[model samples]
Target: MLTLYMEVSLTETQQCCGDVEMLFRRWSVLGLVIPTLLIGACSSTPEKEEISEQPAAELYLESKQRMNTGNYRSAIAHLEALLSRYPFGPHADQVQLDLIYGYYAVSDNAAARAAADRFIRLNPTHKDIDYALYMRGLMSEDEDSNFFQSMFNIDRSDRDPAMVRQAFGDFERLIREYPASKYAPDAARRMIALKNRLARYEVRVAEYYYQREAYVASIGRGKYVVQYMSDTPSVERALELMVESYDKLDMPEAKQDTLAVLKLNYPDNSMVN
Candidate 1:
């Protein structure tokens, strides 16, 4: 009788084990497999919403805000986006002008000049052409602008003259085309400074050649200043160098002519004595 009872208990334990295995199979599909399938399906879905274009006014305002807060790089992004979205929008002209200023504010001299040139070409009759021209000159000046350092008498004579010449041309255009422009006065002042810089650059080059005993080359540089840089202070020094250079070259006649001009222009010049 005890053996029979033990056999019955064993049978019941086997049944319980079978039920657990079935339960596990059902739980695996419901709890794991189905959820994974659902996740995969959800993840595979394509984006259904299109990105809308922001209005040009909105973009302009955003750019303006960025500029006002001194976020120049971000402002450039918005200004560029505005142009891309609405090339001929109501604010197109103003946006182009603002773009030039934006490029300038961040010291992007090349881009600023290019934008100014584009604006002038596209909007010749623009009432604000003066402002565009002014900005072009400003950008050019800023490209070569070391005047602040020049205040300490630091020589900038070794710098490239291309930018200075461009600035001079822009200022001259502004003065000739829009003499009444609000920016004309400032442009005029900057032109004077630029001319002096060019003259000084020529004088410095002539002096360099003179020092190196390259008398012919030195005379050429000095003559350039005397001919084109007429009223500048450097012309006097330039004349002196030319005379010295001529003497070195054994051209006494050339030396006498340069000295005569120096005396005529700068009667009290120390070089004349």
Candidate 2:
């Protein structure tokens, strides 16, 4: 009986020793992590600049003030300082957001998207995620500072299509994943506008094919509108164009098909009788 009791005590001692080793390992991991995070948080910049004891939040605001004054380069300097010194600061998100805006104001779209993307990734659930997403759309559209281009550049050059698609995806994800988000309703509204614009683009391409008398090609585009662009305002116009193309091609069967679809869709039919 004594021997059995001694064996149990030895087992208990072994278990205690294992626990102590595990605890030591955990604490060592924590120690390494804390310092690494601290070092990673540091931002690189000119070493001669003064870092006031005032809060980084205050410095971030000061940077924004520089942006408002049209000192975009100066604003970037301040924002970078905030990024490096206080990566984990309360105002980090706000500072990054300002940096994106400032970069855009300076006509640096690539840099703007990068900064905006960084903020969006870091603060996916921030209250201003909607704003960030919207900014991305506007940035992609080059709608911020190229206002002078409006006079002579109605030809948008497909410059923003891919970016617009990306922005649309981001907003859609935000709405789908965060239905309760304050940004959802507004995002849904903006999504409708984006859809209309994209649909119009589809119509233009279809019209190009139609103008070229490429009946088959035009039919492909028209069907795209009917199938994928039903919600688009240009849908009826697309259907009408399809019917016209079919008639021009002497494809009576296809013409009837197009007319039937148009009638079924737009029974009130002011554009077609």
Candidate 3:
């Protein structure tokens, strides 16, 4: 009876050991599989989330809302995404125009100009072409002067005239190409101001030359002002500058002729007196 009990106990112990070994193997496999499964799940979730594409129409609405709420950056994000995803969508052209406005609103002149140029080049016959041209002219005008200078009454015309001339050209083009466009009136008014400013710039340069006793250079700039910007208020000053320059150069005939013109045009002008 004692021998039988010992053998039975050994057999039970061996069975128990086998069961534990099987459980260990199953747990080991599960450990490796569970980690791989977890890793795969984590990796796939981000990709799925990242690629969640919104419809182009939905993006347009979202961008419009952001713009209405004055959230320009978010509006730009939505607009850019829409453009990337739906290049040929119904709202593509409108989105491009809005981008130009948004960039201009944010004071990003370079991007605004680039977007306007692209729009004009791509959609020559678009109904909104006038608007694009108007916006382009406005961008150039802003480039030549900022709010700070306007607020402080600083003279930006005394600085570079490249942007000024560019703006004038754009405004002139807008007026010439789209005479009946709603933006034409404003563009016309702006062109007048720009012309005056350009004339003043020429006079300022002439004055600088005169101050330095460079009579020839001064006379050249004066003549340019009178010839190019004839309708501007600076014409009187330009004539005066020419007269002074001619006097300095000892050219009596030119001085007398310039004074005569100045007196005929601006009879009460103190410069002529």
The candidate maximizing lDDT is 3
* Clash list (residue pairs), candidate 2: 43-84
- Candidate 1 vs. true structure, TM-score: 0.72
**Residue 115 C-alpha lDDT in model 1:** 91
Worst 10 residues of 3 by lDDT: 1-10
lDDT of 1 by residue, 85-172 (tens): 8998877887788788766655567787899899999989999888888888876776675544555766767877898898899899
Query: Which residue runs does candidate 1 get wrong by more than 4 Å?
Result: 1-53, 147-152
The digit string of per-residue lDDT tens for model 3 on 1-273 reads 001001001122222223333233323422243334334423222221122388877788877766665555456677778888999988888889878876765556788899999999999988878888888888788667655457678786788789888899888988898999888999999999999888988999999999999999999999998888899999888899899899889999989999999999999988666
Instruction: Give the higher-TM-score candidate: 1 or 3.
Output: 3
Q: What is the TM-score of each candidate against the true structure?
A: 0.72, 0.64, 0.78
**Residues 1-70, candidate 2, lDDT per residue (tens digit)?**
0000010011222222232332333334333433344334333232445646557767766775665555
Provide C-alpha RMSD values for all models, in order.
27.1, 21.3, 25.9
Best by TM-score: 3
Model 1 pairs in collision: none
Structure candidate 3, residue pairs in collision: none
Q: How many backbone clashes can be found in candidate 2?
A: 1
A best-first ranking of the candidates according to their TM-score comes to 3, 1, 2
In terms of lDDT, the poorest run of 10 residues in model 2 is 1-10
